[model samples]
Every structure is written in structure tokens, then in C-alpha cells.
Target: MFGKKSRYYGLATVRNTDRQGRIVQAVKLRRLPAAGGVETVVTDGSQLDVMSEHQYRDGARFWHIADANSELEAGELVETTGRVINVPKR
Candidate 1:
């Protein structure tokens, strides 16, 4: 289950059998929206989850921030402190 603010939230899950013949329920990958957001400066020890909580009031929506910034991973986006990042509008 995903959080309310998650992009995958409310998306129907598809059940599929892997090579091992094990059933797995997965959400299809979706293309993220184009980057359009306000710029924000990251302070010391800033993390994506924390920025999400601050910008969107939901820490679980950190992926939104990463996607908006065209980052493949949240960790990569937040790896550097004092960097300018984009916080997407919900």
C-alpha cells in the first residue's frame, strides 16, 4: 500500500507471474510530469523526505520531488548539501 500523496496511490495493481512462477502484485511504472516547481535551497543534512514533508506536508511523497527534478533516485538528489533543488507543486 502507498501513502495518500503517492503518485501510485489508487492505481490498480496488476498481478503477474515471474520467471519463478511466483505471483506478484505490482503497480505499473508511470511517466512523471514535466518539471515545473519553485526553487529551494538545501541546508545541511537535508534529505528528500524532509524536504517533501516541508514542501508538501507528506514525507512519503519524496519521490515527487525527485521526479520533478529528473532524479533517478531520491538519494542522488539529496546527496549534496547546500544545493538548490526544485520542490514540485502538488
Candidate 2:
């Protein structure tokens, strides 16, 4: 038997950077939660835009918004909220 639980969503940042610069760089999108962060396509490995942006002041991680959806306008606020699903062994 198996059991599952519900989890809430919080703000996290997606860390990525533009494909420019001499040594490459990164930047923060600021105030994006875990779910929103996922939507964020952080190019950087850590998505820590270290070269282009700064870290959170209150110890919060970087975050990014989800990609554009036809249902959504040019800009809309969205988030990721759900329990962390654990993958079972095959």
C-alpha cells in the first residue's frame, strides 16, 4: 500500500542568464516560488544568474515565471503548488 499527501507552493527563483558576455553571466528573476520557478527556464546550471543578478536578501531562492500561454495575457501571475511526488522504482 502507498499513501500520498498534499503540499503547498511557495515562491522560488529560477536562475538563468543571457547567452552573452565574455565569461558568461547569470541574473535573478526575484520573488518566484518553487512552482513558478519550474516554469522559469533558467539557462544557468544552478539558475543562479550570478554574473548578471544578485541573490535574495531574506534567504529566498531565485524564481521565474512560466512560459506564455494562449489563455494568459502578455503577462500574468502564476505559481506552482503541490506536494513533492516521489517516483517509485520500476
Candidate 3:
């Protein structure tokens, strides 16, 4: 099982723990497609290592999913759930 794991796999936040140790926060994923198109990210930390302002922004924008793939010709706030990595266990 260990050998089958993705190299980019690592701990990811699945909730927003509060100061009191309560899940008051939202979840977060670990790995992301690297800038060079390689799906890579550090896999030794409990949290996703530092991400630049732009890098973080791009991640947010890419979290889009949709139905049967199709070409776009206009603009709209469509709901989507495209390729999404499962939030790793704590």
C-alpha cells in the first residue's frame, strides 16, 4: 500500500479546528498540479507548505466541476466538481 501511494500525497486539513480544538474551519487538500504540469507537492508536512498569493488564488479558481464536458462560449458562475483529490486523513 505504501508503494502505491502517490508521491504528492500528504496530510491535509479536512476541517477548521478552533482554538478550543473544535472543527470550526473548512477542509483543505495537500497536493496540487505543479506549475510544470507535474502533480507534485511536498509530502512531509502536516499542512500544505507555504503557497504564494497567486498560487493560492489559482487553486481556488481551479476548484470547478461540471457535467458532460463541453466547450465554453460564454461566462457564468457554474457549479463544478472537476478532478478533486480526496482530503487526506489526519
For each predicted model, how many residue pairs clash, with residues at least 3 apart or on different chains? 0, 17, 4
What candidate 2 gets wrong by more than 4 Å, as runs, is 1-10, 22-90
TM-score of each candidate?
0.60, 0.16, 0.20
What is candidate 2's lDDT per residue for 22-60, written digit by digit as tens? 453233234332332122323323222231234233212
Candidate achieving higher lDDT, 2 or 3: 3
Candidates sorted by lDDT, best first: 1, 3, 2
Candidate 3 lDDT: 0.29
TM-score of 3: 0.20
lDDT of 1 at 4: 100
lDDT of 2 at 33: 26
Per-residue lDDT tens digits for candidate 1, residues 3-78, read: 9977679987888999999999988766766778888877778888888898889998887787777566678776
- Largest TM-score belongs to which candidate? 1
What C-alpha lDDT values do all the predictions have?
0.81, 0.26, 0.29
Assess the local accuracy of residue 2 in candidate 2 as a C-alpha lDDT between 0 and 100. 18
